[model samples]
Target: MAKADNIFNIRGRLGDFIFCQRNGKTYVKRYSGGFTKAATQNHPNIKVGQERFAQVSRYVKSLKQQLQPYLWRQKDGTFHNQLMATFLQIAKNETEKTFNELIHELDSYSSLSNKSLNKNSKIDPSTLLYDAKTNKLNLGIIPYELAVKYKGLFLEVATGWYGVNDGEIFLTESNRQYVKLDGQTKNEDQLVDFAPADDLDGQLPFVGLAVVYTDDATSESPHPVHTVMACFVETRNG
Candidate 1:
C-alpha cells in the first residue's frame, strides 16, 4: 500500500479533490469531473463550495512540522550529507522566500524526500569564470588589471612548493615545477634581471597581475599562504 500524498477523504470515501474558483464563487470538487462541473452536478460528491480546502490548513501545518529538523547538519558541519545540508541552508537562509519557490531552483528527486537524501549533489561554478560575450578567458587583458589592483601591495611574484629564494626578483620556466631538494627548483625568481632599488618591497613594481587561488586556510593572512595554485604560472606573462 502506497501513501496517498494529496488525496482527500470526503463522506468516508478515499478519493481526490481540488478547490477552484468559478466566476466569483469558490468551490471544492473532485480532481477529475470537478473543473467545469460541480460536486453535486458533475462528479456527484456529497459536499460543495469552500469545504474542499478544509484539510489544506492541516496539510500545511504538517509540512511545516516535517521541515523543522531540516539540515541540522548545515549549522554544524560535522556531518557530510550534501543534499540535506544545501536544502536546509537554502530553506532557512532565504526567509523572504518559500520552499515551493526555492525548490524550482533545485534538481528534482523521487522515491526519497530530498530532506534525507544523502548524495554528492554539488555544482562547481568554474565554467562561469569565462567572459560572457566572448566565452573565453581574456588572459591578454589581465596584466594591466593586475598592475592596477596590486599597485601598492607587497607581493611575492614567485611562489614555490619546494622552496623560494628569499628576497629574489627573477623567474624562469623551470621555476614553474618543484623538487624535493633545496636550491633545486627553489630559486625560480633569480632568473629575472630586475632593476635593484634601495627597497625591493616598496620601490620595485610587481611583475604582473595574477589570480592566485590559495586554500581558504590562508584567508586570514595578509597574503596567500602555503600550497599556492596555477595563477602564478600566468604571472610570468605579466
Candidate 2:
C-alpha cells in the first residue's frame, strides 16, 4: 500500500506518472489510491482516480514534445547523417586491413596449387586486395544506410541481401538458420532475400536513442548522476 506522496514520487521519476488498463482504454491511479477497491469491483473494466491520472498523463505528453528537438539531434536522429560520414571513414581503414589479410592467404593457397609446375608465379596481391576491398566497401554502405534509417531497432545484418519492413530488418543468420522476430519464428533466409525495402520518404522510424539514468548507488562524489547508452543497428537495406 503506497501513500499518495509515494505515488507522486514514482510518477515524477518514471515519466509516465500513471498506469493504464490492459486494453489501454482505462486509467489507474498514480499511487495506491482506490487500487484495492477497483480490483475488488465486479466490473471487468474500470478507470480509477481519473483526475490525478489525467494530470500525470498530460504532463508526460508535454514533456515528450518539449524534448523532441533535442532528441532528434542525437546520432540516432537527424545527426545520423554525420554518424554515417564518420562510419565511412572508419570502414575504409578496416577494409584495407581485411584486404591485406585476404591477399596473404590467397597467395599462400596459390603457391601450393602451383607447386607441381616447379615455377614461381606473381599472383598480383594488390589487384586481388583492391577487388575484395571494393566489394566489401560497397557492402558496408548498405548497413550504414540501414543503421541511419532504422536508428534504434534491433537489426541483424548477415551476409547476402536482406529486407527492411515497418520497424524490422529481415536478414539471414550468420549460421544460415531461420529468422526470429521478438519471439515468433519466420521463414528461413530465403524470405530475407526477397523482402521489400522500407519507404524512407515516409515516416522515418524514431526510437529511443539512449536511456539515461542516475547511478546514485555507485556515486563516490557529488557528480552529475546521469549516464546514457545509445542503441544502434545495421540492416540489410540501404
Candidate 3:
C-alpha cells in the first residue's frame, strides 16, 4: 500500500486505511488489504519493510509508555500514532542519523515536535530557566494575566534514560511540587528539582517538565485548564 497525504488532516491507521501528509497536500490510502501472508513473505523487500515497521512500532510504544505521565491528559489519541509514523520515516530515509541527531531534528520540527506543550497556557516555556549545576528548574514569576485567574499551579519534573538501539526507556526520578497563586507564592519564583542515579549506562538522558493550572487548589482531581509540558534537555544530545 502507498503512503497517504492526510487529506483528512489526520494521521494513523483507521481500520485498513492509513492517513498522512506529504508536501502540503493531504491524502489517504489503504495500509492493509489484498495481501496473503505467504505472498508477502515471498518478497524480500516486503519482508524487510515489515521488519522495520515492527521495530519502529516497538520503539515508539516504549517511548510513549515512558512519557505517559506527561501526555495522558492530552485528548488527542493520534499524537503517538503520528509520532510513530514520523519515526518510521526517519528510520527509512535517514539510516545514518543517530538518536541524538534525530532529537536535534525534532527540536526544530513542527507539527510533531514536543515544543507545543499547551496552546492555552499563558506561560512561555522558553522563558523558563534550567540550572544545570543545581539540577533546579526555575519557573520565573507567573505573569499577572495568568495569576489573577488560576489560583493553583502544579509543577512536575521528570528525568529518564532512553536506549535508542533497544527501544528501552527508564523513568529514573520524578518531582511534583505545588504552588498557590496567592500574594506570596505568585510573587516569588517556583522551583522543582530532579535527581536520578548516575549509573544508567548506554542510554541518553532526558529531562521533561510539566506545568498545569487549576482553579481549585485542594481539589484532588483538579481539572487543568492550562497545561504546559516539554522535554527541555537531553543531556547526551546537548
RMSD of each: 21.9, 26.6, 13.0
Candidate with top TM-score is 3
**Candidate 3 — what's its lDDT?**
0.51
- List, residue by residue over 168-227, the lDDT tens digit for candidate 1: 222222111111212222223222222222332222111211223322212221332121
| Per-residue error (Å), model 3, residue 22 | 32
- Please identify model 2 stretches exceeding 4 Å from their true place: 1-85, 91-207, 212-226, 236-238
lDDT to native, each model:
0.28, 0.26, 0.51
Q: Return the candidate ranking by lDDT, descending.
A: 3, 1, 2
Q: Pick the candidate with the highest lDDT.
A: 3
- TM-scores of the candidates are 0.18, 0.15, 0.51
Candidate 3, residues 1-238, lDDT tens digits: the string is 4644333577666887877766765567877666678987879778667767777777677767766654455444455676676777767666565443554443323233233333443345544555556755555654333446654554444454434343334544344455555554455666666454465344433444444553322222233424444443423112
lDDT of 2 by residue, 57-119 (tens): 443344234333223222233233333333333334444343223222322122212111101
> Which residue pairs show backbone clashes in model 1?
170-189, 170-192
Ranking by TM-score: 3, 1, 2
Clash totals for all candidate models? 2, 0, 8
lDDT value for candidate 2?
A: 0.26
